[model samples]
Target chain A: MDEVSRKTFLLFGDSLTQRSFDEGGWGGRLASAYQRKADVIARGYSGYNTRWAAYTLEKIFTKGHVPPDLVTIFFGANDAALPDRLNGRQHVPIEEYVAHLRAFVEHIRSVGTKHIILITPPPVDETVRVQENQQKVGGEQEAAMLPERTNAVAGEYAKAVKQLGEELGIPVVDLWSNIQMQPLWQACLSDGLHFTSTGNAAVYHLVQAKINEALPHLRPDALSMDFPGHADIDASSPDSAFKGTAIS
Target chain B: MDEVSRKTFLLFGDSLTQRSFDEGGWGGRLASAYQRKADVIARGYSGYNTRWAAYTLEKIFTKGHVPPDLVTIFFGANDAALPDRLNGRQHVPIEEYVAHLRAFVEHIRSVGTKHIILITPPPVDETVRVQENQQKVGGEQEAAMLPERTNAVAGEYAKAVKQLGEELGIPVVDLWSNIQMQPLWQACLSDGLHFTSTGNAAVYHLVQAKINEALPHLRPDALSMDFPGHADIDASSPDSAFKGTAIS
Candidate 1:
């Protein structure tokens, strides 16, 4: 056995990504899946869109920091805000969203990160969003003027993300289209924007699959475990048992 | 709103703690509970006991690294292995275990972290451990000499941890005693030495309560959220809305 070292998978995004560590959330699933294989670091910034994220990205990926083995860039839920909406401060023009995303990829590359996977935002359920907002604001009259986001707008951002992934040769998880194919797509989102447990599971499955394909050698089973089996430890020098050796 | 600054909750332990990022695991629950508040860093070293962990602790807490705001040190499952067992390489003498715990707490404090929480290992269920080991080793005869751990041994370690915590004036989660108090406590351990999802949930509830009591200001709701509500964003200068302000 050889000394064991750890790699990191960085998950960067907005509220959806921030919530990915919830019970049975995708980030937790990935963390478990990569146990002993890699460190899954969640750098989720809730309510963030591409415009705001662009400012934070440079700060997050500076020269002194270690580069993650893989970085999953998931955004756009807030960026796809409906243009006409008054509180649509989260929105980013589609073109600007694309540019920011590209800049993000370049920045990651500059930091020496080797793998970058882009995840498109999941589709929104307008009916659910409307009803949820109506209850929050007390009536449909006020809700009508404050439709912060629409599925149609989110769809456009998702398309742009997929196109950017292709343009950059990075793998992309097309969550926007893939999630809707589930049996009860509407149940995936608890508040029309954020994910429920079921939605998180869907994202986990897709991301796991993409990882298996893109970085097969770094899969969970492929990494050297940090410690040896109980049967193999040398009792006299317990610490020495794992010092020069890594579990197969 | 002011710029949001997050704290950190460090989970330090063995395999049991390592698996806490699994779906419905305690670490994931904590992460969700602390969303926008803190980063829950899981530093679980599988198959490690107090002796081995003590060696690694110094390396992890060196100066210049960002100090964790809160640290939860949960070990002992592997440390409590029956002395007579052949592969009980994980065992640490009760007195030695107590010393290691103190050293860990001291090291954490030396590095500038202010809060430290200690969690005793959950009790083992011998019947399940035997059955699981029997299936792996082919028969009861082979498993007889390899009773990896016992509830009685774990109980002792738990006592030491509690006593150490009391002397140090640190908050303690007496998991060994509290978990067995649950109905069908046997269901809490998947094998004998590790936690099932049920056990993880039980631990999560206990740790959450202890954190609330010990560090109320660091609780989930007390920390600033990453961004303001969508409705509050000033569209013209959306970035300015969250620039100087932290979501409270």
Candidate 2:
């Protein structure tokens, strides 16, 4: 009945998090880096905002389950949608969004999660978003239609996340500004929202650096492999090499 | 203490399995396909053979833990190593390899695993392996050393795996023969042993096809999302959308 108790790193959020397993995605990169050391679990609900996330918080982080060692809470892109636009149904009032973020942290803490990282939504590309929406609607006639989301509005939500992280004393990856630091940052976004390979790489590097600074013990290199390396095994009597080893 | 229960798919094997989270790896592709439907857990131990895996089976699938819904047991690459070569420490006799494979299935079933898939050792390219080893040793004098593994030897182990699968009434992905079916299959391998992106894609497609044929209900499209999709939510009263949702 002995358990293989590798540490777990959970990613909780919306489509951004859901798509993190795509080729060259941040989540996949993290999983590769932590191979044999920990488990990276993805709990992403696409098209969800902080308000919707609030309703499923307890369900996803149920009390008795083994708590994740580290978690990244990434949200807010959908919450920043313009209230009167076509996608307004996905928007949450700025105040409620901030409150929901706080509640999520409190709930996760109550469930015994040890480390948490808050990632602000990456910068949006308004021009690209508008063009993409126009294409989706299928006509040049809709060219004049207003964009449902704007870079400025997303920036506001990203700022709230940063301020909350400071107030709560939690580490925050300021994705909003960090991504913009890259030359030609707009190219980082594929459809003005989600990431391109470059953007994913940027997020991976940022998160990795944050882990190195805030949770050095969780780094893959710093952790021991679940089992001994093959070179360390006793060739003549392999069982002896694993006889007293703790599976974890 | 309610738990968020998601179906689990476990991948157990050696280095090929260990590196399955790399960009374009079959494991990562599977995870992406099953996002929000199941948790794809990787328990890959590099340079491991059947004998080594036997010692950790119980520890990995402990009695009280929730059994994975599906498990893929992949091995034999290291087991096919020539006994008198530089990597002889990893070799397991063909008879013992087959016995160990059967034991793996029994041990997993004892712990309540529902579905099992076996992936045979992939074909080896002796010329490539020998040249690579020579480069590693950094000397022209080592060029005459025999390869630590041969395609013919690997094929025998693969055949044993297939025969074992039939005897146990389990589905098997005969990677050795399957990869050989590709046009210029040697290009599919990066190092004579490990896979290239093309090889990973091939593995992903083959396993996916097997899932469709034998475990249709476990396919990503056939399963329910852990939570309701955004469009299904009641925007006016968001909580209503999740009021009776099971969150699994």
Candidate 3:
């Protein structure tokens, strides 16, 4: 590919995509690793669920400064995390959550960008609170979610998502199993839910490897472009367009 | 004002605008009585201070599904309600609140639609906790705040706002004194901050009167639109946006 015509890789995820702690986030690392070839746009919002992500996707695609050559979708960590609805102490269900994720996927697909890679949630931590009331809803889906088992939830979600991606004819990077297998993945997690920068880096490198395998003709790391975490991403700068304020 | 063309009055605020209870929120009543016609776009996000309002303004503007010809800005009931940050328990300071309010103003200005109207928050209820902590940084900002002490905070916020409106060449509708004189306004407020529907009605009418006085020519009521509550708005219209896969 021509130096200036390299692909643009956009990362859309939750906290793992945004944490800049130990270093820049996973998206940041992906940018650095593929600095020369791909322009990595990080569209990560901490604590946002699939519903909010679906709502925001429209704005990101339509009003964002520069359109991307490819967009990678990831969420659900927060969708599963429902704060007790104010006063009611009610939680939005996971079934309702899957619907929201589906909507987010549809919204992204509607943008008509052929290149989209759906990534399932990273993994859940084994919390006693998460374990106490864990009930199997039945079938492979229900059977997959065991008490205090994050691996199961990740697996079920990925299975459901694989159906979605295959239906839409888009690729999916199954971060569920990919993350579970990483030797240092568990160690780098900030909580059962979040990740430290190192954890994010692991995910980023994994993504880089996947993208390289999928699009070998277009190696992201070999192209020439700006560093991911350059100090000067101002609101007025073109680079800040994707990272800055709401289009809506 | 012509009967058909009298300016439509729109009420936008917190519980103050909703009229917390029986007060029949200002906008609802204004719609019934105003000759020129007035519609209340009751954007009542209860327990929200300026931060939430700042977050909401742009969304309301961009939605454009149903826009008010004249929009009223009413807050501080909750902004004042925030306890002080230091003791991790003090009232949110007047200056700190002013900044949040300023951000709201900035976002509103950015939208550039709907004529702007500023409504001073209603006086706080006369409560003991608020009275004892009147001088305390965040005490007066919370709902249980008393009228006399909350007045000082309202006065400070109002003064800054008055100056801002004057400087910006916008309209100002002072609710402080008007609310004090009204037997209805105080009666409807549950806490110092939130209003019953009647109180909302009173404020809505007050805003209606001011907007009518300012533009005697436009009738927003005729053009009024409804703000459906968050998708889970009610039992009838469940959020279909995210349909769960629990079809079995």
Candidate 4:
């Protein structure tokens, strides 16, 4: 962290966060927006639930060595899985889900992270999901995957996340509620779980708005641009030209 | 450096590298491809030539602190600008360009960078460049921007880079020649100078191939994946789940 000497935005979450650098994904957009302002590091674990996240937290982020300025934890997608499902490997009950999230937040705050954000799982489109799920897993078992995850169940997790944010006094991005409010919310998800380019754009805009509201100083306009404008560069002493202005 | 404990691929270059995280850009693609294996960090100075890049080397890559495992030096687009052009701000003569590149490679080697790759500037399409330049800068002076950059001129720098790679015993990605060899290479560039999604994909594939050839061990398949599989976890003591397999 001292080596780069720039503010860090650490994103820790599940597959959505893992694929955050997809074509026009939210993470890449954030990276672009924070170009010279800060460094955005994504520590996403696909197919991971809150339990695994809590177990792996200490392994990924230690105290004081490289503390992130802003940390966002997004999970519950896999945790919200139905308990009766064959792939109960990733399912966590609502109570444990809330407890794990609370522990994760407390641990991050204990590490001296000043700003923390908790993003709820987006609403799942079960019809599209079942179709993709069948094609993915294949055979008769695919049709039985009907309610492996439903928007209604995911809504409960979203509500819990919102309540947790209030309890912790941290900012929360209500992706589930806000996304569904959009007229073309269905278009946001590529396969009822992952985000399409449109979905990424929607998240980017929402996240950008939140950053502006909660941490205005981290905004693009607030941070210094890279290398000073080309015209301002002093040809003779190129080093001094960007001395104070550079992102050292 | 020890904080993350993961390998780092540091991209050192001009605007092309700066915009490497753009939608479907190469850097983000590389980062995704190398997820859990290594990190791809961008140290791009937009609108900068090799001269300025040389001046800022020490400031960006200090000795013994967060030394990169693989360093990529990408420039020559700005440097290849015609000497007598209006945009002389970015032009570095062929001789100085080669010398600066050599110095950069040597400096990186001195800092213990295990792998070094020199990426030649992709060829400039003069016809498309003139059109974009006219729209961007505008007015009668636009026409005089005639040879601000030319494929033939950029080819010289690419040749010099390849030659330097031979002298320095490093791999070189001959982007200028290989890209044009593709059908409808003009579609590769978004605005004559920068790459479109197609161009980024082309460069990424070529660079991936080069990495496989030069540093096969760094390939995604070669490096170990992050965390152990979830099914193997000991539910009682989760810490033992990743005893020897974690990203420590």
Candidate that would win on TM-score: 2
Order of the predicted models by lDDT, top scorer first: 2, 4, 1, 3
Q: How much lDDT does candidate 1 score?
A: 0.79
TM-score of chain B of each: 0.92, 0.94, 0.64, 0.93
In model 4 chain B, the worst 10-residue window by lDDT is B239-248
Which pairs, if any, clash in model 1? Answer: B1-B245, B1-B246, B2-B244, B2-B245, B2-B246
* Cα lDDT tens digits for candidate 2, B1-248: 22555788899999988899998899999999889887787999999998888878888888767788899999999999999876888999999899888888988898899799999999998888888878877546543377889999999999999999899999999999999999999988998999999999999999999998988998778998987899999888776778853221
Top candidate (DockQ) = 2
Q: Which candidate leads in lDDT? A: 2
Candidate 1: misplaced stretches above 4 Å? A1-4, A85-87, A138-150, A227-232, A244-248, B1-4, B142-148, B226-232, B242-248
Tens-digit lDDT track of model 1 for A190-247: 9887889889999999998887898777667777765555456666865576564211
Error of 4 at A184 (Å): 2.6
Candidate 4 C-alpha error for residue A126, in Å: 0.9
Off by over 4 Å in 4: A1-4, A136-139, A142-145, A236-239, A244-248, B1-5, B142-145, B231-239, B244-248
lDDT of each: 0.79, 0.87, 0.53, 0.82
The per-residue C-alpha lDDT of model 1 at residue A214 equals 82
Query: Worst 10-residue stretch by lDDT in candidate 4 chain A?
Result: A239-248
lDDT of 1 by residue, B1-248 (tens): 01236677878898877888987899988988877667676778877887777655655566666677888999998888877663466678899888888889987888899999999988888877777767777665764535678888889899999899989999999999999899999888888667788888999999999878887887777787655554566656756765642211
Angstrom error of the Cα, residue A99, model 4: value is 1.5
TM-score, cand. 2: 0.96
Q: Residues A140-225, candidate 2: write the lDDT tens digits.
A: 64443778888888899999999999999899999999999999999889999999989999999999999999889987789888
Candidate RMSDs in order: 4.4, 2.4, 17.7, 2.9
Error of 3 at A87 (Å): 14
